[model samples]
Target: MTRLGDGVRLAVGTLTAVPVPAPRQIDRAVAGVAMALGPFAALPLAAAAGLIVLGGAAIGLPAPAVAALALGAVALGSRGLHLDGLADTADGLGASYDRAKALDVMRRGDSGPTGIATLVLVLLVQFGALTGAISAGHGAAAAVVAVLCGRCVLSLCCAKGVPSARPEGLGATVAQSVPRAVAALVFVVAAGLATLAPGLPWWRGLLAVAVGYAAAALVLARCVQRIGGITGDVLGGCVEAAVAGALLATA
Candidate 1:
């Protein structure tokens, strides 16, 4: 039988996007396809963005609903990766003064009031931006662009100078394994095109890029200073935050 141990190792390596192939190659051919997982991560958000557009068109759904649904899409696509970070960061930041305590709080699986509050705030901001965009009569295209931009921010974050916080967490794995240039190039071209889709002023796109990057940098700086480096959750929060900033700029 194809050994389960070998299978697990292969799967982990692939999901982690590690270039180093394992010696005990599992019969799990699916392992090879794992290489695409990093890029494929963008699809869910894109789908969610589409759904928000549909929601907007069908009844001119209020901004809150569109934002909620759109944020839902981002959550679905990311599988709550960043939300996890947001939760952990909240718990960690809320409980302790030093770095170690903060890290420990975050590492714990249990949620606390801080985590809950953080998630609520993040979702609210996301929804507000979606509402503003829709109200501006941008249609689903704005949602799509925001989703694309968010992913692009994620890719850029992973690709750039920020190092990983944990040795084995998702963020570090991506930072270490993925080809920085290819991933970054794909995200930039895709996001730039998507953000410009609304046919807004050229200045709007530039503004979004500038504002998004600035916000991301500040957040990243905090993550690094607070807990040593960027975590997977930090990456997700950054993406959502960037999208919010982008929508606000466009709005």
Candidate 2:
């Protein structure tokens, strides 16, 4: 039980700007455990973002503005870590098809034309889909579902079959940390919650889950084929892509 609490603390501390203290020990096993618990840590952040969207809507804000606000809240809460990952992954993959070159580009910490383009396109799609959902009176529900799906994909990325692209760093520490069964269980719970999200039709909720899973899977497969395995950036990219896909489905 103490270990579980520590894992949760580690997850929340690392993944978000939430005010949780660091765990007493930081090791591979602890990091792996934290990755498995990531979905739970994301719940409060998602709820906060959902409330922001709903509140903005209640004040008669435009759908696009409200969606942007919600996105801003999420980025602030997570310190834009995921967004950074997304941009790096895009730049690396787009700069070259060569695996080593791609990895090198990703390590440079600077956005290239392809990275900038990818970020712009993805953010636009996310904003557009969120605006559509809000216009349809599903802003809060869509926010929650999208955020949950995004975090859930992290578990999938860490599943036992997934390998790390590098020998060191976060990607390797969390690589294969989550058992396939655990990933499946997280997905089942996420899907069930999606079905219960307020203002979403059951069919649409299911579709959101399906789209999120497919997007994550596609990204994972491509990363594995291109880079030989997953990286921290790849995981981040998967989360954003899954969120966009889920929100689009809801819309």
- Predicted model with the maximum TM-score: 2
Cα lDDT tens digits, model 1, 65-131, are 7767776766755567656766776677677778777777777867799888977886676677667
Candidate 1 Cα misplacement greater than 4 A, ranges:
1-40, 176-191
TM-score per prediction, in order, is 0.73, 0.96
lDDT of 2 by residue, 1-251 (tens): 66777789988987889998878886666766788788788888899889988899888998888999999889888998888898999898888889899988988879888888888898899999999999999989998899889988888998998899989777888888887898898889888878887899888888898898899899889889888788888988999999899999988
Q: Model 1, residue 108: displacement in angstroms? A: 0.6
- Tell me each candidate's RMSD, in Å, in order: 6.3, 1.2
**How well does candidate 2 match the true structure, expressed as C-alpha RMSD?**
1.2
Clashing pairs in 2: none
For model 1, what is the error of residue 171's alpha carbon versus the real structure, in angstroms, after optimal superposition? Answer: 3.1
Q: Which 10 consecutive residues of model 1 have the lowest summed lDDT? A: 27-36
Q: Which candidate gets the maximum lDDT versus the true structure?
A: 2
lDDT, each prediction: 0.61, 0.87
